[model samples]
Target: MKLPNPARRSISPFGQRGLKSFASIPGPTSLPIVGTLHKYMPIIGEYKFDRLHHNGLKKYKKYGPVIREEIVPGVNLVWLFDPNDIEVMFRCEGKYPQRRSHLALEKFRLDRPNVYNTGGLLPTNGPEWFKIRKIFQKGLSGPLAVKRFLKGTDEIILEWLERVEIIRGKQNLDYLPELSRLFLELTGHATLDLLLKSFSRDELNRHSTSSKLIKSALDTNSCILKLDNGPQLWKKFDTPLYRKLKKSQKYMENVAIDLLSLKMSLFSERSNNTQTLLEQYLSCPDLDFKDIIGMVCDFLLAGIDTATYTTGFLIYHLGKSPSIQMSLYEEAKRLLPNKDSPVTEEVLSEAFYSKAVLKELFRLRPISVGIGRVLNEDAVFSDYEVPKDTVVVSQNQVSCRLDKYVPCPNEFKPERWLKSHPLYQKNHPYLLLPFGHGPRSCIAKHLAEQNILVLLLKLIRNYKIEWNGPVLDSKSLLINMPDGPILATFHAR
Candidate 1:
C-alpha cells in the first residue's frame, strides 16, 4: 500500500519530514490506527518468538532490500539489506551516531533515578554518550589494556577448561550454561580483578550473583527486542514483559552496587596496585559512584552474552567441519609449539589462520541479524528518500549470505578471509562487520578478540571438537545463539 507523502506534512527545522508520512517506501499492508499489527500475527503465532528472524528474512525477500514497515502506529522503520545502500545510510550519519533507542531500557533507567540517571553507553546519546565512550576507550581499548589482562584472563579460561574436563566423557554434554559461566568468569576477572566462581560445583550457589546478572541482562535484552521488533504493546501498558524487565533491572542494579562497594572497599585497603577496568573507572573524577558502578555493570551485561555466543558459533562451525578444525589445530600448533604454554599478544598476532576463522565465522553468523542506526539526517536508499529520525537497519546477515558478495557464502570457508585465496577477491570488507564500524563501533573489540583467541588457542590444542546432534539452529535475541543445548563430544588430544 502507498504511504502518505512525508513532504506534505509538517517539517522540522532540521529538515525532517512528517513522522507518519512514508509514502515513498514500500511495506506490508497496514490499517489506520493499528498500522501493520495484523500482518505479523502469523509470524508471532501464540507468542512463539523463534520466527522473528525467519519473518524478517521472508519480508526482505518479498519487499526487496530497501523496504519500510510501520511496526507501531506512528513509528516507521526503513530496513536495508543492500551493501551499497548500507554504505549510503552510514555515510549520512552525523558526528554523533545514534543507534536505535532502547525504549524499555530508557524507561527502566529512568524508573530508578539514583542508580542510572545517566544511562550507560547503550541508551545515552550526544555529549553524555561521547563522554562515556571516551572513558570506555581509555579503560577497555588499547594494546596495553589487553596485554595487562592476558595472563589473568588465560588463567580463568584454564579453570573453565578444568570444569569442562569433568563432563567431557559424557555422551551429550550441555555446553550452553558452561559457556555462559566461562564468559561471566572472564568478564568478572577482567572488570573486577576477581573470579566470579559462577561455574563452581555448588548446586546451591550455582545461580551466583554473576550468573543472575547475566541472566537478567539477557532477559532484559529479549524484552527490548520484543518491544522494538514485535508489536508496540509495551508502550501502552505495563505488560508482563515490561514487569519482567523491571524486575531484571532491579536485580542488575543491586548486583552492580554490590560490586561497586566491593571495589571501593578494595581501593581503601590498597590490597593490590593492579589497575583493573573497574579501578580505572573508579579513578575518573568526573564520574560519580553511581555512574562508575553503572559502567561496570554495563561491561558485565553487554560483554557476557555476545562473547559467549560468538565463541559458541565458532565452535559449532568448526566442530561440524572436521577438516577445517584440523587445519585450525595445525595453525595453532605452528604458532605456539607448546600446547601447555600461555598465549601472548605477540603469539596471537601471528596466529593468522585462527583470526581468519573467527572473521569468517562472524561473516556467516553476525552477533545479530543486522546493525541499527537512527539517521541523524535525511538519507536516500535506492530512489526512496528516508527522512531524519527514521530507524535504518542494515541486514548484515542477508548481505553476507548472498553468494555474489562472498563466493559460496553458506559454506564454512575461513580461507576466504585470507587475502591469499582466490575467493578472497569476492569479499567486500564492509559486508562483514561483526564489531560494526566508525566512531561508535564496539569499544570491547580488542578485548573480545584477545579473549576468544586465548580460549581457542588452548581449546584447539587440547581437544578434537565434534558436534553430532539435531541441526543446531540460531535464535536472535540481541545476540544470535543456538536454539537448544549444543551437544558436543570433546575428545582430548
Candidate 2:
C-alpha cells in the first residue's frame, strides 16, 4: 500500500479556519443558466461519469487546476486536477469529514439514524459510523478474508463458465447480468451461505440467456443510479425516469425487506445452521430490522452492480488483448489443469496473471470516475480554501493515468503493480480511490476484491474469450456499465 516514491512529508492535519472565495471560478455557458442554478438538469440524460471525466480533463486543461465549477446553479463545486489535493480530502475525511450528498443513498433504509446504522460503513457518519465498521469487520479478519470468499467465488465462477458454454454460439451471451447474478450467488452462498433470490434456480441454472428475468429491480437501477448524478435529489422525483426508478427502488426495497424478515425469523428460531453475512447482521445485538434493511440493501446495490460491470470490462479487455489473454490462459492452465476439476480458492490465488490483469482493469475502468464529499467545514488546501458544504470531488480516472505516478499510464500493463517491477511507481498510498478511501469509504472493499479476483480466475481458466464489441467506447450511465451487450466468444478451455 506504500507509494512507489517516498517523499519527505509530515503526517499532518488540515487546519480549519474561515471560509474564502473560490481560487478561480469557470463561467458556465456550456449549457445555459438552468445549469447555472441547478447543474444536474443538463448532465442527467446527456453526459455520464466517463464523459464528465473526459470533459473535466478538457476543462481543467483550459481553465486551470482546481477550477471552482458548479454542477448546479448556486451550488459551489470544484473540479480538482491535482491528485494530491484529492488524496488530502480522502485522508482527512475521517478527521475533517467530507459529507455525502447522495439523496437516493441518504433515503436508503439501511442508513437510517435510529436502527442498524451503517455510519462508518456506508453513507453514515459520527459514532454510528464507528460502531457499524467495528461490527461489519468482526468476522472479516485475517484468514477468513481470503479463504471464505475465495473458495465460494471459485466454485460459483466455474458454474458460470459452464452456463456460458451452454449458450455459446447458439445465442448471444450477455456477461453483465450473468456476472451480476453470479456475484450475488457467490456472495450469498459463500460469505452468507444464502441464495441471492435475485433470480430463481430455474432462471439461474438455465443455459438459455433468454431465461433471465432482467426485470425493473435490476434494470431500473441503471437509470436510478444515473439520476443520482443529476440535479437535486427531490427534483428527480418529477421526472419520468425518476418515477420508473422509484418503482424499481420499491421492488428492490421489498426484496430486501423480505430477506430481512426471513433472516430475523431464522434468528428467532435460533437456527444453528451457519449464517451468511446478512444473517449474522440480523443477529447482531446492535442492529434492528431497519438497520438490517439499510446495510443489506447497501450490500446488494453496491455488490451486484459494480462486480458485473468490472468483470465485463476486464473480459472486454482480454478479448482485445490476445497476448495478455494467452498469458492468462497459461497461468490458469498451470494452476488449474484438469478441465473437469472445479476451481479452488488456492488455484484462483495461484493465477497471479489474472490477479495482475484485474488490477490493471480496475485501474483502467474503476466503477466510479470520482467520489464526492461535501466538506462540512472550510478547510485549507495549500494556498486555496475549500469552503464548507462545497462538494469536494476527486478524479481516480485521471489519477491512475498520472504519468508521474504510473509510467506509461495508458498501457494495459499489470507488471507495474508487482513487487519486482522496476518501472512500477508507487501511487500515493492513499490516492488509489478505486473503492474510495478513509472512514466513509467502502467497508466491503475486501469482499469486492475477493469476488472480482475469484471470478476473473474462474473465467480465464475455463474459457477463451474474444470480444465482439469495439474496445474503445466511453458509454455512460450512472455507475459505469457496458455501452451495449458485450458480445463475446467463449470457447471452452
Candidate 3:
C-alpha cells in the first residue's frame, strides 16, 4: 500500500482548521490519577511492561495505527504504527532528535557533576548531544573508518571460535554467554585497542576484569529496565535500585578512566598508521578527557549485549532452516574459500546473501521495543493533531510484522530484501530501521555490522549449525534477548 505523503499532513499552523484535537486520538481508557498506568497492572490489566513489543501489536489491532496513552499522570505517549506517520516523526525530529530514554541513567550522571559532562549520547539531548556526537562521528561515522577494524575484528572471531570448540565439547551449548564475551573483546579492541582476552583460558575466571565489566553492564541494564518501567520512586530519592545502578556506573567509570589514562600515556609511542577508535578520539583537538571517557563507557555498555543477541538470533535462524543455512554457506564459501581467509572490504561488499539474512533477522526480531522521539513541533498523524513535545514512538517492530506491510510477516524469508529476487519487497525506507535513522542513529552501526558479518562468514564456512533445543522466543530486558538458553550444536564440516 502506498502511504499518504507525511509532508502534506504534518506541521500545520496552530490555528489551522479541521484538524482533529490530539485528545481525540483513540487509546485504552485512562483513569483520573493513574492515567493509563492501570492498564499494565497485574491481573486487572492486559499489558505487561516487559512484553512491550507484544503490547504494541495488540494496541495496533485494537486502536488502529495511531494509539495514545498517558503512561503516567504527566507522561503522554503517542505510538505511530503507520510508516507514513513514522516518516513524519523523523522529518520533524529537527536537528537534535531528543529520544527520552535512560532517564534513570541521565539522572545518575547529572547527579555526578564532577565526573560527567552530560548523560552521554544515549540520554543526552539538544546542543550538548550534538557537540559530543560531532566529535565521535569523526571517528566512526562511515564504513571507511569501520573497515579499518575488520582485520583485528576477524582475529578476535577466530580466537573465539577456538574457545567455542573447546567449551562445546560435542554437546549443545548455550552460546549467548560466549558470544557476549566475544563481543566484549571485539568492543574493547575496536574502542580502546585493548585486548580484553575474554576467551582466554586463563581469563575465564569470574574474578577477571572482563567478567566484572560484563556482569556490571548486565546488572546496570536490568536496573535500568526496572527503574524505567516501575513507579520510578528513585527520581525523588535514592531507592535501592537507584543505588545499585550508581554502584555499577561507578565501577564502569573507574575502568574507563583507568583505560583512558593508560591510553594517553602511550599515545605518543603508538604509530600514526592505523588508529583505534579511542586513538581517533584522543587525536581530536576539541574533545576533552571527560568527553572521550564518557564515549568509551557508552560504546562498551551499548555494544556487547546488542551484538551478542543479534548474532545469537542470526545463528538460531540459520540452525532452524537448513535450506537458508546451505544457501548462506554457498555464499560464505564463495567469499571465504579458506577457513583463514581475511574478511576484507571487497568480501564484505560481496556477501549479499549474508547481509540479507541479517536484515531479515532484524525485521523478525529487532533489538529495541521501538524507536521513540519527543516531537520538536506539532504534527498531524492519522489525521489527529498531535501537539509539540509529545512523545511519538515509531512502532517499526509492530509495523514490520503486519501482513498489511509485509507479505509473509511470520516467515523467515531473506529474499524479500533482495532487489534481484522475485520475492523482493518494495518496503518504505522507514519500515525496518534496526539501527534507527538520521543524526541520532546508532554511532557504532558500521562497526557492529562488520563484527556480525565477519563472525557469520567464518562460522558458516567452518561448521553446520543445528538447533538442539526448544523453540526460541524473546523477552525484553531493555533490549530483546532470547527468553531461554540458545542450545545449538555446531557440526564441523
- Comparing 2 and 3 by lDDT, which wins? 3
Instruction: Give the CA lDDT, 0 to 100, for residue 225 in model 2.
Output: 44
Cα lDDT tens digits, model 1, 1-493, are: 1222333321233334433235757777667887776665665542234444566667777888778877677778788876767776677667888886567777677666777757677778788888878877886666666788898887888888887888788777778777888888888788777776776765215466766777887887777777766665676788898899888878877877887788789787886677667777788787778777677767877788888888887778888999988988898788768767788878887888888888888887788877788888776666566788888888887778876676677898888778887667644445777887777878888788889989988899889998866776678787787777777888888
Clash count (model 2, backbone only): 13
lDDT of 3: 0.86
- Go through the candidates in order and give the C-alpha RMSD of each one to the true structure: 5.1, 4.6, 1.6
By TM-score, the best candidate is 3
Name the lDDT value of residue 54 in candidate 3.
89
Q: After best superposition, candidate 3 residue 489: deviation in angstroms?
A: 0.3
Q: Supply every candidate's count of residue pairs whose N, Cα or C atoms clash at under 3 angstroms.
A: 1, 13, 0
lDDT for each candidate structure: 0.76, 0.62, 0.86
Model 2 residue 35 distance off true place after TM-score fit, in angstroms: 4.0
**Cα lDDT tens digits for candidate 2, 187-302:** 55643455555445555554522222234335555564445545555463546666665565555566667656775676677647766666677677886776655555556666
Candidate 1 C-alpha error for residue 389, in Å: 1.3
Better of 1 and 3 by TM-score: 3
